[model samples]
Each structure stands twice: as structure tokens, then as C-alpha cells.
Target: MENAYKEIEKGYLNMELLRFTTAGSVDDGKSTLIGRLLYDSKAIFEDQMEAIERASVGKGEEEVNLALLTDGLKAEREQGITIDVAYRYFATPKRKFIIADTPGHVQYTRNMVTGASTANAALILIDARNGVIEQTKRHSFIASLLQIPHLIICINKMDLVEFKQERYEEIKKEFSKFAPKLAIKDIRFLPISAKLGDNVVDKSKNTPWYEGPTLMYLLENLHIGGDNNFLDARFPVQYVVRPQSDKYHDFRGYAGRISSGVFKTGDEVKVYPSGFTSKVKGIHFGDKALKQAFPPQSVTITLEDDIDISRGDIIIKKNDTPKIEQDIDLMVCWFNERPLQIRGKYAVKHTTNDVRCMIKDIEYKIDVNSLEKDYDDKVVKMNDICRISIRTTKSLYFDPYTRNRETGSLVLIDESTNETVAAGMII
Candidate 1:
């Protein structure tokens, strides 16, 4: 299949990046768990470790707090609470990882949605001492609603609960009740002590009755390559590259990342809005032509015929076009401090297209903790996920979020300030 963005991308198509988010209630040791993963995986540099040690010394702590490694903000360091989503990067021989450690506080629930929006797996921390709290269910709901493939329930602070098998079972039992209502397909629960380093990297000597793969083992072995939508091909054109230089004067290229499915060098393709068909002449990364392209890859595609294609136009297979509708129903998480207005006019960003949209009607408000849909509440507040309908000025071609996150997901930006106010997933 012809991918339209193969002619204008950086040539080398060699690296892979995995985005995973850490979530849980406040004091659930999310930051500490991330530090443990980085430390145990031997991904931390000496300078980074030195800074952590110095920070520990300043706090007069006996041992360096591993959570300090990801909590880079001054307010988070001073208040001992994560205020914003903190991202950390590290790599192992098996895979490269990007950790989006989001705040566990309820008010910052919007941050968790932002972090987990693109995550393949979610690391949910549960404090053994408190068992399953209200916040536990909230994060789980968000992960499922976002259509994340895997959920790892890390029962943290196991040492404080004496590593008792019964206590762990109790918490697990409570969570199992609510798991049925979620969209999660695979769920695994583990007992861990983020503070004592139990069952995080290597197996623990403390939990003698428990035996399972360590957190690192699960992350390294989880099959995530097949997590993308293989049936639908959606590549939103980011830019049209045409160099006026001597050698490449006639070169025309469409540059963008392949959001889903696969693209081959000699397949026929179509461009949206204009509904023009073209054949794939050559698929190039920078200079070398590729045999094919897949999800999460950024490449430049050169077509056989020059058709009028520009930014915001999606390149997709002709027969497998998405449902184009002017109105859509979605679950939206309001992220703005300013209250959401009824029948408000905001710019809706779907894929690469931005159109003026109006909030038609709120179907219902979802209780994140209970996973219950409350239709009686029509008003959407900050951090609330309400099923809503939006009518756009132009029709948008989209698939369900479960099928294609790249095309099915969108954001609502305030028209005046141009700030993102909500994130939505098509239902």
C-alpha cells in the first residue's frame, strides 16, 4: 500500500518508543515505583543518581528516595506531591521506555488522561495498607475508557502489610468485582513494596508465599507490537514538502507518521476530502525506498501522480475509508479550570483537521470510581467524563477509538485562549 508521507521523513526507520503511564492514588508510591524500575534496570546515570542522593541528604533522609528521580518540578520536590505529569526516559536491552508519571490526586485526573491517552499498558499502584481506595477505581476506569491494552495492578507497600497472602487476596478480591465493568481484556495483579524493592526488579525474599514475574519481567516480555489497529490505515498529512533546490526541484512529498495498519511500496491509495486516487511510485524514508511501513513510524511517501494534497488531508486505503460524520458521540474529560459551557463553540481537533464545533448535548456523566453512567447530571465539571455529542462545521472521517486511536481521538481547545480544555474518545 502506498503511504503518502514516505518521501519527506528522516531516512533511518530504526528506533521504537513505548509510552506507559504510572497511575494511582496519592501516597500510592507511583513515583517510587518508577524510580525502582529505573534503578533496578540500571538505566540511571551517575549524575542523576548523584542529584537524587544530594536531594535525599538535604531532606535528612536515611536512604535516597527513588521517587525523587522523576519528580523534577520544584513544587513537587518541596511539597512532596506530584503536581503535574512528569516524564522519564530509560532503556534496556529488551526495549526503550518512556514513563509518564502522572499525579494521583483527584484534581489532576486530567493529567492522567493526557498521559494514558497513548499508553500501551498502565501501571496502577495500590497501597496494601489501605486496600482498594476510591482512587483505585478511578484510574482503572480511565485506563479502560482510553482502550489501553494491558493493566498491571501493582499492590504496593506490601511490606507494611506484612506481605500477608490474605491481605493481598482481600485487595485483589475487591478489585475483581469492578473489573467486569471495564473494557480491559488482560489484567494482572502483583504484590510489591516500592519502598523495600520487593518484586519490582528481581523477586523478593520477603514475600515467600508469592511467586510471579517481577515488574521488569512483565514490562520486557509483554507483547505490545501488535497493539495497533491493523485493519485501518490512517496517516494524517503533517506537511507537504517541495524543495526548490537544483537536484530535487521536481520532488513532491507528503510528510507524516503512519498512525495505524501497514503500507507497502506499490499499493494504490486515496486522499481524503479531494477523493483522489494515486499509485505508489516509491516509498522513501529520506533517500532509500522502503518495502513497507507500519504503525508508529514516521516516513515520507512519494506518489506516482501529483494530486492536490495538503496538510490536514488523511491518506488511507480507498475501500477501508472511515465513517465520515458531522456529528459524533464521545466520552470527554474536561481539563479546564473554567467551567464547561453548555452549547459552547470550541475548535475541535481530530487527527490533523481543526474545525469549529458546538457541544450539542451531554448524554451522561460517568462516575469514575463506580463506573456508573449518570444521565441525570447534564452539567460537565472539571475532570468529569461525560458522554457528549458534537456537531462540526465539516464532516470528519473517524473510526471507533478501539479500532483507531489516531483518528478516533480528539481534543477540545478553548476558542479564545487556544488552550486545550478537554480530551475526547469516540464511542
Candidate 2:
């Protein structure tokens, strides 16, 4: 038991996390593919499997419907569709995975944007029989707009197309023509049958002509180490930690997740908005002291100088400071039903900074289908994406969304209702 426990702990420590989102048209097998991936990987518990089995029988399914595993909501199960973003977690020996199964309907495009916002990779499913359709282009455009590092185009439902290599090749060729227009760095194509478990977790004999890594293999082995912006060091202070206990009264640390780049002890740093200079005295992760901290790590840092630093302040290398500007240009994806009001005041949240901003102008709206910019149609509505300018009440420290996703993104909240109205990516 001791040996087994040690082996398990070692495996857990060595595992890398991969966050991916799945998207396709309605009935294109997004949920089913996730369910199949989980089931074949042996990640599903026996009791959970039995419950799904019972539900499948109640629905009069001839065979157990794997899609039922993810359609957990009563409305989703009744309508036979995914309405919201359904997140699922599973782990293989090689890596741990977080799957965001986004809705496929055109109305839920906002949900798709929210789901794929922080993803490292995107799994775009194309129905083999229908080939590349409009929804496929929409999702692909959003994936590129969000700057997801990897794109895996899974041509699904090979059983319907009789597992024909020609069909897969045709769809691949069609999508390749459109893929060049996007800004995605890496794009790969694969053929799979989610229902029959072909080329998902294991190699399928049905596709003898196709030779490629399985979906699971591609996800587990994809290179994501270079996806983060490591050159520009940025640390947004989320909280100012001060120990009140008598044991450690002198503790003053700024705690936040590293948004980008690297921070190390003894490095010269500057506080944003105040322009105060300081040296890093220490970096702490819980009770353990770390020599350095990088992106996505929540570590408490102590500076040599006791400056007036607080929440919403950014700390960075003195030489590589980000642009501190109040007027910003960005691409906005409107998420509310009410049309965006010109010159409207909305609360903007970026990183750890909060400020109110007003819409100055709508430069153009890009049609996701054709990638055309329309300067005439400025009325932005739900799911309408456009490029606009905004002037903030206070200066913001940010980079282009293409440069650093963590520092380059923000959300606009409706001041009256406190609802998030839109998500913006800085240009």
C-alpha cells in the first residue's frame, strides 16, 4: 500500500494540465465525443455509468447514449441539446484534462466565446456528411480571435460516411482553404467516429486508409509550454497580505497570480501607477519559499521597499513596462440582448484593475462568416462582434491580446444590472 501510494503521488506531481474546449454545429457530436472520450479512457465511475445507462433506457435509446453523460440539465436532456457550457474533468496517466463542451447553436455563440476564452486548445468538430458549414466557420473564427494556441479539427461521424478516406480528405481540403485566414498558430485534422470509438481513444480498423494520432494522443502530447508570454514579466497584485498574528507581525506580501513572464527574488521591479522602484525580497507559495514564479502561479511576493502598493496595481520589470493608456481599441463580442449603446458608461474589469469606460466609436463589425469588416452597421447586438474604441476613466496597463491573453483581455459590465455585457480583446 505504501509503494502504491508513493507511485500515485509521483504520477500526480508529474502530470501536466491541458485545458481544451469542444465546439461544432448542433447535433455535430460535441457532447457525444466528450462522453465517448471519458468512457473509453476509463475515467467514468461505475456508478455514474450505471446511472447514465438507466437514463438512456428511460429515453428508449437502443444502445446506451454516451451523450447523456454530459447533458446533465433537465432542459438539456429533454431538448437533446447542450444549452450552456458544460465543463468536464478527466485524467490519463500522461496528463490531466479539462474539457469545456460548449453549445453548438448559433444563439449560444456568446456561451462558446466564454468557454473558449481561457482554453489552450480548441477541438472543432465537422460533420463528415455535411462537410464544413457556417457554424464551423463561426467557431473557428472565435477560436482564432481568442488566440487559442492549437486547433484540432475532428471530422466526426465517419460511420455515416462509411469511414471513407475520400470524404475525410475532401472535408480537410475544404477547411484548409479557410484555415489560412485565421491567426491560429497550429492546426491539425483527424477523422473519428465518436459513437463507434474510432480514432478517439484507440485506433479503429474501420479507417485502414487513414493513419494519424488518436484524439486522446494528440491532446496528451500537444506542445503547450511556449503558449504563455514568458518574455514580458507582469504581476497584478490581487491582494495585500498582512499577517496580524504575533508570530509574524512583519509579514507584508502582495499576492496575485502571475499574469505573464517571470518574477524572481532580488530582481529590480517597479510598481505601476505609482512608478516606485523596489527589489523583490522573497517569493512564497504557501509555507514554501520559491526562487522564482511564473505565469498562472499564485504566489505571495515581498519587496525590499515598503511602497504604497495595493490591489489593482501591477508590478513589472522596470525596463519592460506595458503601455499605460486610457484610450484603447479592441474587438468586442457583445453578450447581452440589448444593443450596445454608443457613448454608454460601463464598468470595465481588466486583470486586477477596475475602471469605468465609455464607447467612443464603433470602427467596424466583422462578419464571422466571410471575415468582412462593415463600418456602416455599428449597432452591436447579442453575439455581434465588432471593433470599437473606448476611453477609460483611469489609465490601464495592458498589452495586445495577441501578445498576452491574461493582460490583454477585459469584460464590460452593465452598470445598472451588474451583468456582463461584453468581452473585449485589446488590439
Candidate 3:
């Protein structure tokens, strides 16, 4: 048993990771779909399956409820609804997956944003009997707003509609009509029965008219290498590493994660806010030196020349730099209970830098359901998304969210309470 456990752990460490989020209306089978995926892939432990079986029987269920696998919280199981974001990890031979099962209610829109913010792909489930509804549009709009690279519209509960091709076509057509308005780069439609395990992992024999790959197959084969911004190099220094040792007495290295693009040894780089130039002497992961570092890599970099670089400083290729400005425009998603006050002073955190900012103007609040700009309403409350302009105490170096997600995002915090009030994407 010990040897087998070690082998399984080794295999997981070698697999590539894919993060995805699911959104759907109540009882649309979002949890069940994820449960089905895990079960069919043989990712669940036997003990977990046994526990779910017991719970189902206790609830007087006729069949083992796969949704019970993800709905772990007592409230969620008792109410038959997901409130908070439930994250589950599973792996197949080809890849590992991080599933963010977000709540479907409109009130929990903030939860969906929190889950999908870092996802590479989003699964928007639509009930076959209901076709496309307001919740569908709301979730679809949120997925597009987050700039997720891929979107999969799963027409779930196909068995309920007798697996009819006509119903699938109807929902597909309705979704296609509104998709052009969104900023989604790639989109695909799949007819699935999460309850009966049709097309969740293996291809369903019932859908002869369908020719596309199953959800599992698409997830495994999807090209995600190009999803990150590889052209723009942005490294936000998180800490300054200076070891107090005899062997490395004069060593000064900047420690941080490469948010995007590439950084190589001996490359000429410029520091933001300071405008000082330096050359990369070496990149070290620890004791070993790395020739290059790319997106999402954490390393310590030694510079050729000593410069006044700090935690908030950003290192980038001199020629290709982000716009530095005190005045900024962004789409803000309000997270706190209190409504956003115009000209309100709040702390703004961009990358590794922190500064205070005031709301200069509220351009318009977005009606997510209708995708309309509510110019008349400027009061921003919880779960409200709006376009707004702000003025910061210092210059912020950033790109549009569409250009680079890592460098283009920020959050606002209420200083008095130190609670994060809103999330923003540069526009």
C-alpha cells in the first residue's frame, strides 16, 4: 500500500494542471457533472465512494447522488445548493485538473468571479428543458468579462429532454446569437447528461447527431500553452534576498514570480518608477542557476549593477514596457456590502505595489443580465460590476487585462477595516 501510494503521488506531480470553473442555474447538475468526471476517471478513492453511498441512502435517494461528492458542506447538502466556491482536485493519466464549482444563484455572483478569475476555461451549463435563461446570460457575460481563454457551453440534463437533437439545436442557436457580443476567444457546445453519466467522460452512444469530442477529451486535448502572455515580460519583485553569510556576503538578488513573458540571464532590463537600467547577471532557483525564467516561475535574480530596487519595483525588457500613469480606468467588481462611494479613498494593490486611490468617476454600471450599461445608476454595491476611473497616489505600470491578465489586474481595500472591497481589470 505504501509503495502504491508513492507511485500515485509521483504520477500526480508529473501531470500538467488545468484549472476550470463551472457555472449554472440551480439543479443544473454542476456538482454532479464534476462528480461524474471524477468517478468516470477513477480519480475518487473507494472510501469516498462508500461515504457518498451512505449519505445517499440516508437521504432516501433511489440512486447514489454523485453531486454529494462535491457538495461537502452540511448546509450545501441539506439545502441542495452550492453557496461558496467548492474546489476539487483530480488527475487522469494525461493531466491534472482543478475544478472550481461556483454557486448558481444571482446573489452569489461574487463567488463565481472569485473562482473564475484564474481559470483557463469556463463551463457554463444550461438546462435542456429551460434552454437559455437569464442565469445563462449572466454567467456567460461573467465568463467573457474575466477574459477566460476558452468557454464550453454544456447543455446538461439531456436525458430529461429525451436526448432530442432539436432541443440541443435550439439552445445552441440561442447561445450563438449572443456570443458575438462577448469577448470569448474560443467556444464549443456539448450535449451532456451529468445525471446518467452520458458524455461526461466517455462519448455517449445516444447522441449520434453529435460529432464533437466529449467534455473529458476536449479538456485533455485543449491547447492551453498560448493562453498566457508570452510576448510581454513583466516581473514584479516580491522580496529582496540578501543572505548574511561569508560565502555570499555581497549577494543582492530580487525575489519574485515572473508574472508573464520571459526573462533570461544577461538580458537588459529596466526598473519601473525608478527608470534605472540594469543587466541580469544570473537567475537562481536556489543553489543552481537558470538560463531563463518564464511566466509563473519563482526565482531570485542577481543584477549586474546595484540599483535601488524594492518589492514594488517591476523588471521588464527595456523596449517593451507597460503604460505608467496615475490616472487609470478599469471595470470594477464590487465585493463588499457597503456601496462604493464616489471619491472614496481606498488602498489599491497592483501586482506587488500598494498605493492609495480615489474614485474619480463612475462611468457606468453594467447590467450583467442584459449586458447594458446603466448610466443612470452609479451606486455600486455587492456583486455590481461597473466601469470607473481612478487616480492613484503613484504611477501604476500596467497593460489592459486583454493584453496580460497578470499585470492588468488589481484590488481595492478599505483601509479602516482592511477588507478587500473590489477587484478591477484595466480597460
Candidate 4:
């Protein structure tokens, strides 16, 4: 038992985390694929399995409905559709995973965007019978827009199509024809039957022609170490840490998560807005002092000079500073039911910075289905993706969304209701 515990602890320490989102049209086997992936990998508990089995029996299912594992909402189970985003967590010996199961309906595009915004990889399931549909294209486009590093196109429900290689090739070819238009870095195609447990967690005997790695193997082995931008160092100050203790009386540290790049001790850094320059005195992670800090690390950094740094201020390397702009162009996904009013003011939040912004102009609305720009349609409604210009009250330290996602994204909130109205990516 002690040996097993040691192995578990080692696995926990060595495992890398992977965040992925699943998207497809309604009735596609996304939930089932995740359910199968969890079940076959022994990630699900015995009690959970029993509960799922009982739910299946109560629903009069002939066999256990794997889809029930992710479709947790009553409305989702009753309507036999996903209405909102459902997140699931599981771990294997090699890696840990957080699965964002997004809704498939066209009306839930905002929900999909919210779930997929932070994902490193996107699993776009294409039903074998339907081939490449509108939703597939929409999701694929969003994945590209959001700069998801990896895209795995899973042609699900191969059992219904006799697991034919010809069908799979046809879909792959069709998708590849238009894929060049998008800016996706890595894209892979896979054939699988989510319901029958084929090519999900295990290799399937049905597909003798398919020689690619199984979905589980591909996910586990995919190289994601280089996904983050380490070239342009960006650190947004979240809080100013000033403890009122005797031992740490002189300690003044800036606490924030490293957005990108690297900051090492004695590195010359420039503070945004103020344009104040200082040297990085030390990088601390809790009680231990780190030699350097990189992307996604939440650490406190003390500087050599006492600069007036506050929340919303960014610390960047002197040579690699980002754009300081008040007027910004963005590709925004409108999330509110109320239409966007031109010249109307909205509270804009980017990183740790909060500022008010006025809509300058509606550049054009994107027809997600046809991938065309509708310049005539200035009325931005719910689920409408459009490019617009906005002028902020204060200058923002930002990079293009394609370059660094952490520093490139912002959201507009309705001041009256204090609800998020739109999500935007800086252009």
C-alpha cells in the first residue's frame, strides 16, 4: 500500500495539466466521448458508476448512457441536449485534464466562447453521417480566433457508418480545403465511435486502415510546453503586498500571475502607464525564492526601486514592451440580449485593469456560418461576432490576441446591470 501511495504521489508531482474543450452540433457524441474517456480510463468512481447505471435504468435506456456523465443539468437530460458549459476533472498517470463540455446549439455560442477561451486544445467532433456542418465550421473558426494551440477533429459515430476509411477521408479532405483560411497552428483528424469505446481510451479493431495514435495517447503525448509566449515578458500587477509586520517591515512586493515571457532576478523591468524603470530584486513563490518566474506562475516580485506601482499596472522587460493604446480595435462576441449601442459607454476589464470604454464604430459583423463580413449590419445582437473600435478612458498595455492571449483579451460589461455584455480580442 505504501509503495502504491508513493507511485501515486510521484505521478501527481510529475503530471502536466491539459485544459481542453469539446464542441459539436446537437446530438453529436461529445458527452459520450468524454464519458467513455473517463469510464475506460478508470477515472470514474464505483459509486459514480452505480449512480450512472441507476440513472440509465430509470431513463429506460437499454444500455448505460455514457452521455449522462456530462449532461448533469435536468434540462439537459430532459431535452437530450446540452444548454450550458459543463466542466469535468480527471487525471491519469501521465497527465491531468480539465474538460470543458460546451453547448452545441447555435444560441449557446456565447457559452461555447466562455468555456473555450482558456482551453489549450479544442476537440471538434464531426458526426460521420452529417459530414462537416455549420456548427463544425463555427466551432473551428472560434478555436482559431481564440488561438487554441491544438485542434483535434474527431469524426465521431463511426459505428453507424461501418467505420469506413473512405467516409473519414472525405470529411478530412472537405475540412482541409477551407482550413488554410484559419490561423490554427496544429490540426489533427481522428475517427472514433464514442458510444462503442473506439479510439477514445483504447485502440479499435474496427479501423484497420487508421494507423494514427488513439485519442488518449495523442492527448497524453502532445507537446504543449512551447504553447505559452516566453519571448515577450508581461506581468500585470494584481495587488500591492505590504505586510505590517516587524520582520518584513521593509518588504514591498507586487503580486500577480505572470502573463507571458520570463522575469529573472536583477532583470531590468519597466512599469506600464508610469514608464518607471526598476530592476527585479527577487522573485518569491510563497516562502521559497525563485530564480525566475514565467507564464502562469502566481508570485510576488520585489523591485530594486520604490516605484508607485498599483493594480492595473503591468511590469514588462525594458526591451520587450507592449503597445500602450487608448483606441483599440477588437473582434467582439456580443453576449447580452440587448443590442449594442454605438457610442455607448461600457466598463472594460482587461487583465487586472478596469476602465470605461465607448464604442467608436461597428466595423463589421461576421457571418459565422458563411465566414463573410456583413458590413451593412451595424446592429450587434446576442451571439453576433463583429469587429468594432473602442476608445478607453485610460491607456491600456496590451498585445495582439494572436501574440499573447493573456494580455490581449478584454470584456465589456453593461454598467447599468453590471453584467458582462461582450468578450473581445484585441486586434
Which of 1 and 4 is the better model by lDDT?
4
For model 2, what is the alpha-carbon lDDT of residue 59? Answer: 82
Regions of model 3 farther than 4 Å from truth: 1-14
Residue-by-residue lDDT tens digits, candidate 1, 133-228: 889899998998899899999999999988899999999999998899889898999999888898988899888888788888888788887888
Which lDDT tens digits does candidate 2 get at residues 18-56? Answer: 999988644888777888888777889999989989998
Candidate 1 regions exceeding 4 Å error are 1-16, 60-63
Best by TM-score: 4
lDDT per model, in order?
0.86, 0.92, 0.91, 0.92
Candidates 2 and 3, the one with greater lDDT: 2
Q: Summing lDDT over every window of 10 consecutive residues in candidate 2, give the lowest-scoring window.
A: 23-32
- Candidate 3 weakest ten by summed lDDT: 23-32
> Model 4 lDDT vs. the true structure?
0.92
Lowest summed lDDT across 10 adjacent residues in model 1 is found at: 7-16
| TM-score for each model | 0.92, 0.97, 0.95, 0.97
lDDT for position 86 in model 4:
89
lDDT of model number 3: 0.91
Instruction: Please estimate how well model 1 matches the true structure, expressed as its whole-model Cα lDDT.
Output: 0.86
C-alpha RMSD between model 2 and the true structure: 1.4
